[model samples]
Target: MSSRFRLFDRTAVMGSGYIFAMVNRMQMLYYILILPKHLVQPYMIVGILGVGVLSQINLFILAKYLTSNYFVLGYRGFVQLFSEKIVRFFALLGIFFILIKVIVTTLGYVEIVHQFMFPSMKTSWLIFVLMASGFYIASQGMEKTIRLSIISFLATIWVILVYIPYFLPPISEIHHLYPLVPGEVSLHSWYGLLMVWSALSGPEYLVCLGPWIGPKEKILRGMSIGNALSVFEYLVLFVACLLYYGSPYLEKISFPVVNMIRYLQSPVFERVDLILISLNMIYFLYLIALFLLCLYGAIRIVAGRINIKTNRKGFLGSVAAVFICMLIINGWYWREG
Candidate 1:
């Protein structure tokens, strides 16, 4: 039971891991990189500013609500009986949410990779690599994930800063942003943005980490830093994509961020998008590990309170096995679809 609690403590760090994972797995290959072929640049500006803004706010609210109720109060307050029950319920719900998200992301990534990078590679191989990496990281637990996240986040910032000059020259006009908000934002777009934003909630990763953290204040501080990092990363990436490609191009590209950076040419460098892709891949790997940790945590909470006996290694391995199986099934489905 105590080890189960420990796992949840670490998962709280991995909750927000999906954001970076999404950026790499879904956003890069599918949208931005493909933008120039379909849409121009102006429409993308519209989508990013309009849809992106609403999405962040919506996701923040959802994160705040869910994090407070499930991770912070319910699971973290392990000593309390009432909190335990609430935590268990929310843990299951979180598992369901993450599973759905992982499936959709896996499908989207498959499409992106199939279209962009490796048309020749079988999707199952990709899944295997992803699962292998995910399992390796999940086995390490939360501390390494958190530490690695900090490093990845820092490294990406340096990469962006180093490459900033190339993108500076082709700055598009703000008048391109003329009609800011459309007639009315649709519910579907709103939902999309909300999903994007909710995708940033990383505190759920902390569920696996709570016990490891000595002081309550330290956990709060970590959550603050992690969430802030997520918001800032999204904002910077969104702005970079919008500024480089504009809204017109955004509507066309499958992954705007990668496309925005791909064409970057200097005397020294030809294609910066390659570097960005590598960096994003690192981030995504870290994020996937985080999600696995979170799933492991959630399962532990439910299993423990229910008096199901399972060791921590057994529990984590079981969850990873399940996730990998799901990824395989999803990959094959999308292959046929």
Candidate 2:
């Protein structure tokens, strides 16, 4: 292998607790464009922060319990907090959710890449490449996955600066930032408010991460800061979308966040969004690995069947099966389209 080309260093393992928090933030970065349309209003910044408090509530609930509980009991300790049957049942439900999410998210990103990055490429080939990339990261163990998560976060943090154009006028309307109509929040807006909470969904995987962290490191500060940063990023994106397109119009668009990035072709570098989207795959790949690792944990929790540690290939096979299903489902959609 050439020094110029590298995959990942196999020997470099880092603190899982530190990496997990940053990974938490990375997982939710995609939500910046999507959630704003749901929750932001004319009083954009204030509206988002107001809704943000509610969004962070559920995250805080899990963070409060998990960090404290994990510090003392770890996974078994946290698991025993619930009845044996109850914990297993929920873990099974989590398996179902994570399985669907992993498949759908990979398929969705593949479609995005197909549309934006590789218009002429075959979707089948793209799916194959994606699953292969995911499996590569998965085989690295949770330690290495966390390491990649840290490095990817550093690499992609600059993408946030790409939004500077959207924040300025006449692309953005300053008038939209003011309060328009004031009354009791409508049921639809209320429902959208609740949906903002989903932006914080991926952090709960920290519970399964206890084993990955050695006894010396603590996760409380890591999880708390990570959770806080995810919410803050969501708020910034949410408001940015509202500033660009007011609430009513924002809701009509699909993938507002992605489009927000798409709408701005940088004055400095043309079609910067395209380059950013390609760079974003670095973070997305890490997230896919993270999700698969979490799915592996869920399977162990519910079935106690597979030992991912000893049989690395078994874990990779299980992850491959999930991604393959995306292509299987894609056929039905293709036929309909």
Candidate 3:
């Protein structure tokens, strides 16, 4: 007998812990790896905190929607609110957004892996291997894919502690954090604030997972904690970068966080940075899998087949289409920003 493909099947309602893990991990995507280089000014530390507060307020509004009776209804809830036609239209728009996110995120990480981990390897093979891993994880169904979030969180969160050495004397300079206030603000400073806001944006996507997320009362608490943690991680990272490289030197580094990891020396492990990068893959794969599943669901909704039984061919075809798009963009359009 052939197995049935049920991409959105929800066997269990996940608690706030899952929500917390997912939100935290989503906010800490590939962008966080390169954020410090963009917001190199020490005064931008204030931007990080300010944007984090704004993100919290936004999450408050989002929590209202998530807690409503309509939210748990999932697709039907959206249909009731916007009508089937409008919901379909929204799903249509979602397809493009999801595609761009998956493409950019996957390709960005592939470039990192290519540059840092395997410079000798072709980028195309790296993309294939990563997507295949994601496809296999996503094939397990939404619940399992979501359950992987906690694992992803735990596996990589400890890496933050590795940066502690950067905070101490020999590697760090007290004067590097001086002049924490900006004397004259410019367009570049505002741009840095916007980047910080953008970095904290992944929680908004949680609105779509209403059916799986639970304990409506605790949703806000979970999300708030997650958002707070993301900000703290951002602060820790940016400060460490400043202490280690200072604002002027930080501006020149491409991947400041990854480069900082390279500075550490371990007796047993020849390449500690490589090990951390590999561990980072757990969350990267988790997110790619989650988005792949989301993309397939969006495709189904757009095709007016939300109720239809999912088949392997349709699912594989959607993933393949995305893979091809990645290949095309990587080959022709992708440029290092």
Best by lDDT: 3
> Candidate 3, residues 94-118: lDDT per residue as tens digits?
8888898889889988888888999
Q: 182, model 1: CA deviation in Å? A: 4.1
> Candidate 2 residues 1-337, lDDT tens each?
1332221223432454554545465446455445665665764455546655654565566556554644344446655777667767888898888877777666777777777778899888987887789878876666777767777877776676766676888888877666756456787676665666555566666666655543333444565566666666765666677789876788787767777776766578877668877887887788888788778767666776532233655566677678667788876763310
The per-prediction tally of clashing pairs is 44, 1, 0
**Model 1: per-residue Cα lDDT at residue 154:** 57
All candidates in order of lDDT, best leading: 3, 2, 1
How does candidate 3 score on lDDT?
0.90
The residue ranges of model 2 lying beyond 4 angstroms of the native Cα positions read 1-20, 26-29, 43-47, 68-88, 180-184, 214-218, 247-252, 262-269, 306-309, 333-337
> What C-alpha lDDT values do all the predictions have?
0.53, 0.65, 0.90
Top TM-score model: 3
Check candidate 2 and list the clashing pairs.
33-257
As a whole number from 0 to 100, the lDDT of residue 174 in candidate 3 is 83
User: What lDDT does model 1 reach?
Assistant: 0.53
